[model samples]
Target: MKHLLSTHDLDVPTVAAIMNVADHMSEINARSVPKVPALLGRTVASVFFEDSTRTRVSFETAAKRLSADTMSFSASTSSVNKGESIRDTIETLSAIGVDAFVVRHASSGVPVSVTEWTDASVVNAGDGWHQHPTQALLDAYTITRELGTGNTLAGVRVAIVGDIKHSRVARSNIDLFARLGARVTLVAPGMLLPAGLAGPGITVTDALDDVLPDVEVLYMLRVQRERMDAGLLPVGGEYSARFGLDERRARMLSGDAIVMHPGPMNRGIEMVMDPAELPGSRILAQVRNGVSVRMAVLFRLLGDGQLGA
Candidate 1:
């Protein structure tokens, strides 16, 4: 509960606690003003080495809602452009009395390193292909809210389809969903599956149809084109054609099954999902939950529920 570096570090109770707080935060969003002074004197520093819009803005808005001052330091305009190290930037920010840090780096373990170097508690927005803990939590919250209690994963099947090798979201969700009692199936072409992935009650498959009928949720991830050049994923249209979840694939699921995609969705690359259509789509819901979920995270990390009240 100290620093959220990875989902693997959180026990089931800790995850449940955060989700409960997120439910409280969801209630706050329905209020007239939707602002609190719980973190009035506190400050949150965001150090984003990677390009992002949703995660960064969500954290900023969350801190603001709690009345915490926010400082955003990205690679483009910072001393990082001058070749300054992450350690130097972290120390500089920490010396200024930051209460917490929300970091997203291109390299895995950077958040963990930041936690070691600074007194500020660190929340990992993302780290390479490692984890996006907050995203996983929000997705979990969305599922719980939609399905209600006892609707956890126990007998429900979930298919996480797309670039698993480069998807930090997939990695985090895989762990989180499994921990919450869901049966997870990671579907992707051979090269896209993460190396050394096994156990923890997950099944790996290249065939979409194999897991479709039983799946209650189809979680899609955008294929990382950048990883193709780096050799982590294969190139081309053929790969997507074979694996992408189009209308045809969408029809294969149960009538009540839901479809979810974390934003910056590849309209044609990941799936042929039309934003205007798709009845059970929860993509927009994820964005809305991001604000409330992040608000809960900031409130808890800052040591009070008043901020989100």
Candidate 2:
């Protein structure tokens, strides 16, 4: 729990502890004075090398809720525009007393490299296709809340639909969900799915229909057009025609099945179904839980660790 670079870095007990803390963090929203003094003297730095709205603001809210001071830095207007290298930027930030770094970088493993340069605890907000640990954590919290207590998704089948090749969220969710005792089924076209990603408890398949009926959770991912280096699909219409989760496909789920998407969804591309209107859609809850889950993470990493103890 020292650093959250990847979901692969956390064991089952630590992951559960963080989730329990998030449950307590959620309760703070109900209090007359919600703010905690846990991170009173600490400081967190959010360094974004890519564009963001939700992730950045949620982490900022999380830090502030715990009474931690934050230094928000984005590469778009910073020394990065002056041709300053990431190394120099790290050195500059290190000159200030930064307690933790919540980093979102375009290149994979950049957060791990940041850890090498500073004593700050590194939480990988995202690192290209490498991982987004907190995103996975929030999604886990959302599912647990929806299912209620003593409801472990041990044998529950989950189908992660849509883009997989360039999604750090998808990669992190797959690993984290498996670790939390869910059976993960990855469904995407051959070109869209990552190669050599299968393991014992996980299965990779292009047959979406086969995976649909049995899935307890149908997680959709947005196709990242910004991350594309070359032409993978002919067109959006063609891609959707072949693989999108349309209304017909949405009907395949069981009565208690839930539909999920990490936001900024593409209407007709990855998910043809109206995710917001779906009864089982917990997308908005994922966004709210992002703040609480991150609050839990910040408190654990920077706080006194007695909030949920």
Q: Write the per-residue lDDT of candidate 2 for residues 25-100, one digit (tens) a residue.
A: 9999558988988888888999999988789999999999889999999999798999998878887888888888
- Clashing residue pairs for model 1: none
Stretches of candidate 1 exceeding 4 Å from the true structure? 229-236, 304-309
Residue-level lDDT of model 1, residues 56-133, one tens digit each, is 999999999889999999999898999999999999999988999999999999999997889888999999988999
Model 2 residue 50 lDDT score: 92
Query: Which regions in candidate 2 have their CA more than 4 angstroms from the true location?
Result: 149-152, 226-229, 304-309
Which 10 successive residues of model 2 have the least lDDT summed?
A: 300-309
Indicate which candidate wins on lDDT.
2
The TM-score that candidate 2 achieves is: 0.93
